[model samples]
Target: MSMEKISIIVSKGSLEGIYPALIMANGARAEGIEANLFFTFFGLDAVSTKRSGHVKIGAVGNPGLHLATFIGALPGVSGLMTRYMARKMDRLDIPPIPEFIEMISDTGAGLYACKAACDLFGLTKDDLVPQVKDIITVGEFYEIAEGGQIVYT
Candidate 1:
């Protein structure tokens, strides 16, 4: 059977963490497949108006960076990596997080925030970006994501 839908769960707050889901969802939309992005836990930072623009890369403890934990943990290292990656993405014409989310939303893809996560973080509906359709529970997400492939990142 052909894949008709996708449900991507973003759980991390970093740049690396959020971009994969954005790319996947945008790709799915481009392919005419139904797509939904569910932002939960720390991932909410990617959709938060206050934090989306400021989300940083997680260099510490990230094996992909190939850096020692201590070095990655140093002040300014994460910020440096984040800026470096942002510049690279810019060179490739990739939009930043806010604009990316807007583009994804314009594609008719669904964007949602986890209600439990919002409650845990003391966030209200007004605190998130306008692209978020709603703040929903896991069960609600399941209901919306039913019959779709589930990808967690």
Candidate 2:
């Protein structure tokens, strides 16, 4: 049987954005689907060992945090709060970020960093996680996502 593909675009640098992509892609792969993650702009940090684990959850002065803690929490606000808590766990050396990224990649998910973004950031292929498949253009990413469901996170 031909496996269905799920393409995920990650555009944020925060732990909130990165984990969802990893979780979803890993989940898709667990179900035997072909999973691909495209990292662009700040999202490239998700696939970069140097930056992936360093993401800070914005708690202080964050509009979302203020809204969640005050004026009653939104429907999905708890999840955001959970993500913020997880960042603190990292400080305790629990479930390191690299381990999480490895867990996702080990499931056969294809990871790609945006070539344009890499150039803009002065990052080379060597700067990314060793598991990354390639540095590709947005066009190349779209070509991969053509027949699949594409999700932006």
TM-score for each model: 0.98, 0.78
By how many angstroms RMSD does model 1 differ from the true structure?
A: 0.6
lDDT of each: 0.96, 0.80
Off by over 4 Å in 1: none
Which prediction has the highest TM-score against the true structure? 1
Among all candidates shown, the one with the greatest lDDT = 1
